[model samples]
Target: MQNIENKVAYITGGSKGIGFGIAKILVENGLKVAISGRNLDDLQEAQAVLGEDNLLVFQSDVINFEDEVNSVKRVIERFGKLDVVIANAGVGKFAPVDEISLDDWNAMIATNLTGVFHTLKASVEELKKSKGYYISIASLAGTNFFAGGAGYNASKFGVVGFTQAAMLDLRKHDIKCTTIMPGSVTSNFADHVPSDSDAWKIQPSDLGEMVIHLLQMNANVLPSKIEVRPSKTS
Candidate 1:
């Protein structure tokens, strides 16, 4: 396993759900992390849960390019170096194609697609210096489309294509890129209430473990893309 001790990770939407889980694992392995989110209260609560001194919280909306740039700068300024970036902030809303409002579609594109671009744009230079890894949290919808998910599918599909192109662009510098597409994760994404309906879904921690495994892979090889789904889905 590659040693991540003393490494610094910048994670968007790290206040809860998948981002928070990944942050916990990285911190446990001796990495210093800066977790960013739109809500300061939630970010602070997450920082408290992760404990003080190891995790730093930054409140910024990933959709804003300037904010993204400043947040990356802040992370490097505070931590001295940045090794990994996880673009995990996203939103999902279900609606029929004809019923989907333009605002909803735009929101999905802004947060899920453009947000990743802004994040990478903000951190690519630092990543190039450290030959770091960039992980984009896409979804199975990127490949497998379904009803009432038109906007989300479009954003995720764009993410899949974007990450692959970025991998090719970054590989020459020894920088790695990975797009993780998970299916039916049990979380409060886009206002979905957690219930027994989510019993068979994958947990946030499972994705965190996947991240650890990917980061631990030999530097000589890059997996590039990983598709994760529940073993028992109806």
Candidate 2:
């Protein structure tokens, strides 16, 4: 396994849910992690849970390119170098195409699709310097369409395509890009509070473990895309 000690990682949407889960694992394994979210309170709460050492919390909204640029600057300023980035910020709006409001559709596209691009654009230079890894958290909805999922599906599909092309572009630089498509994760996504009933679904930490696994693989080996789900249906 590759030695991850003292490396730095920046995760967007890192204040909670899957992002927080990944941040926690990375910190435990001796990485310095900087997590960004739009909510200062959520970021603070995460800092408290994860503790101060090896963690930095910043407030950032992924939809804004300027915010992402500032976030990368802050991470580099704090940790010296950025070796990994996880674009985990996203939103979901479930409704029929005809019924989905223009505002909701725009929000999904901006946050879920364009936001990923902004993160990559802002950090690509630093990632190139580190020859790092970029991982985006997509969804199974990217490949399988379902009723009332028009907006979410479109955004996630775009993410899958975007990440694949990015992988091709970055590999020559020794940078790895991967998109993780998960099914039914037990997260506070879509405003659903996690509960015991969610035990059967994939947990945030499971994805965290996967991230570690990817990071530890041999330098020449790359799993460009991964689709993960619970072992049993919930």
Candidate 3:
């Protein structure tokens, strides 16, 4: 219903799972999308799945500042303007507090929190020009802590804090910011994918549809923080 026929969106971690799912739906809704991943092979495969006409693939690491900038540059060059940006790339390594390594903690922070900063920094000007939207895919772990998830929690909680502040700062520019938190999504998260044993888990498409729903919301109102969970968790 919301017409995005010419709007351009850039989604990171889009080779598979929730990122790719959102990319697919955005394309179906007539938005031009640029999807990024670290692996060229995965990006190519995702491109094929989504059809190359409405989807562009960029192979870049979100943790790398130059690569993130180049990705935004490429999208602007191709689409002329960027109307939306989703910082959906993330990584997690679970370990008890005493067992967590510095490398693991840094990786979580870099990709989950700093990666988002890079994403917004790279695209902020275009978003200001177009009065666009920015969304970050955080996690329930951000608000609800659990053991062995300290690093992940820290990153996501930081994402929530950062995006909320950004929302305040960017509102005057007419650029919206939102943080989406989901629980137990059925993905290759921590190397676990959907299976019969996981029939009740939240599918990536569910979150994909949510992204579409958020985009279609009336411009006058902002859904700043959305918390999503499976309705019938067993």
Candidate 4:
């Protein structure tokens, strides 16, 4: 197993939901964490809740390459080094293929797929120095298709494929990479509010635990692609 104490981590979309959950876990595990979001208010709120001692908050949009680059730079500057980078910023829009607007499709592509690319590209150099871990929060939709999921499916599928290829590429440099594909997570993503209907679904903190487990895995082991789902249907 790897020793993860006192390491530095940067997580995109870390203001809420799964990203926030993961950031909390990292901080609890003695890892210095930098959490980024486009909303400074949300970021500040998270920082207050998480703690100021080992947490850094940044305003960033993963869809913007410069934002990603600056976020990474800020993390490195504040922490002196970065050992983990998680790309968890994403948006979802569900609609029939014919009903999906060009704008919606483009938005999903830019934020979900291209955003992960930007995050990885901006942090890859720092990761190489630390032989760190790079993780992307994809979705089960990457593999399974539903009736109203053309745009989302395309973006997630791209994320899965991109993460796998990145994993193979980074392994040679001793940098680990993985994609976490989850199903039916209870969160307010894409304007959906979590309620009792989602009790049977995966919780945001479950992903945080999964990341902690991955970080503690043996250096020789790499669970590159993980799919987590609810134990039972609701």
Candidate 5:
């Protein structure tokens, strides 16, 4: 297992949900973590909980490539180097293909698909320097289509495809890329409040542990694509 102590990681959408979970775990395991989100209040709140010693918070929107570039620069400035990048920022909108509004579809595609590209593009050079790891939080919807999930499905499917191709491209440089496709995570995705009713779903912390496991793997081993679901369905 590779030692992750003192390595630096930048997680998009790290203010809450899966990103926050990953940031928390990475910090506990002795990593310097930078978390970015568009919401300053939420970012500050997360910094308070995660503490100032190992955490840096930035207000960034993934839809803008410039924002991502600046974020990577800031991470490097604060932590010196970035060894991990998690493209976990995403938004979901569910509607029938015919009924989905242009605004909603564009929002999903821009934030979920294009956003991943921007994040990776902005950080690839630093990752090459560190021979690091990049992980994107995709979704089971990428592979499974549902009645009202046209927009969401398209975006996640793009994420899965993009990350897989990126994995192939980055491996020769000794950089590892993986897309984690999760099902029914208990998060505030799509404005749904997490509650006891979500007990059967996968938890954000569960995914966090998965990230740590991947980071600890031998350099020669790479689980390029992973599909994770809850053991029991609600």
Candidate 6:
């Protein structure tokens, strides 16, 4: 297992859900965490819950390339280095292929696919410098197709593909890249709010633990792509 103590991590969409869960765990494990979102209020709320120690908040929108780049710089300036990045911010727009509006499709592409790309492009240099890790939070939809999932599926599929290729490109530099594709996660993603009814679904903290496991794994091994799901479904 690699020593993650004192390493710095940047997590997009860390205000809530899986990203927040990951940040919570990383902080507990002695890594400095910087979480970014577009809303200052949400970031502040997260700060209250996650505590102030080893935490930095950046109000960044990953869809904007410059925003992502500046965020990288800001975090580096505050923490002096960046060792891990989790591209966990994503949006979903579900509709039949024919009924999917252009705006919805574009929004999914921008926030889910292009945003990951921008996050990576902005942070890759720092990762290379630190010989760090890059993790993209994709979805099982990247490989599965269903009615009314056109836009979401396309964006997630793109993320999985992009992250895999990035793993190949980055391994030579000793920067690990991975994509985590989850199924039926209980979170406030899209129209779903997690509740007792979603107990059968994977929990946010479970996903966070997965990232922790990856970080603790031997550096010679990489679970480049991982698919996680609920143990049982009703």
Clashes of each: 0, 0, 0, 0, 0, 0
User: lDDT of all the models against the reference?
Assistant: 0.92, 0.94, 0.91, 0.93, 0.95, 0.93
Residue 149 shift from truth in candidate 1, angstroms: 1.1
Looking at model 6, which ten-residue stretch has the lowest summed lDDT?
Answer: 186-195
For model 3, what is the C-alpha lDDT against the true structure? 0.91
Record all residue pairs in model 2 with backbone atoms less than 3 Å apart, i.e. clashing: none
RMSD of each: 1.2, 0.6, 1.1, 0.9, 0.7, 0.9
lDDT of 3 by residue, 1-234 (tens): 455677899999999988988888888888999999898988989888999887789888989989889999999889899999999999989999899999999999999999999999999999999999999999999899999999999999999999999999999999999999999788877777668876687788888788888778888889999998888877
- As a whole number from 0 to 100, the lDDT of residue 74 in candidate 4 is 93
Estimate, for each residue in 1-234, the C-alpha lDDT of model 2 and write its tens digit.
788889899999999999999999898888999999999999999999999988989999999999999999999888899999999999998999899999999999999999999999999999999999999999999999999999999999999999999999999999999999999898899999999999999988989889999999999899988999899996
On lDDT, the stronger of 3 and 5 is 5
Q: Ranking by lDDT, best first?
A: 5, 2, 4, 6, 1, 3
User: Model 6, 1-234: lDDT tens per residue?
Assistant: 788899999999999988888888888889999999988998999999888879999799998999999989988998999999999999888889999999999999999999999999999999999999999999999999889999999999999999999999999999999999999888888867778998888888899889989998998999999999899985
Q: Give one digit per residue, the lDDT tens place, for model 4 in 39-157.
A: 89989999989999999998999889999999998988898999999999999888999899999999999999999999999999999999999999999999999899999999999
lDDT of 6 at 97: 97
Q: Is candidate 2 or candidate 4 better by lDDT?
A: 2
Ranking by TM-score: 2, 5, 6, 4, 3, 1
TM-score of model 2 vs. true structure: 0.99
lDDT per residue for candidate 1 within 111-194, as digits (tens), equals: 999999999999999999999999999999999999999999999999999999999999998899999999889887887777
The TM-score measured for candidate 1 stands at: 0.96
Off by over 4 Å in 1: 195-197
What is the per-residue lDDT of model 5 for residues 1-234, given as tens digits with 9 covering 90 to 100?
999999999999999998998899999999999999999999999999999998889999999999999999999999899999999999988778899999999999999999999999999999999999999999999899899998999999999999999999999999999999999899888888889999999999899899999999998899999999999988
lDDT of 6 at 205: 89
Cα error, residue 120 of model 3, in Å, equals: 0.4
Off by over 4 Å in 4: none
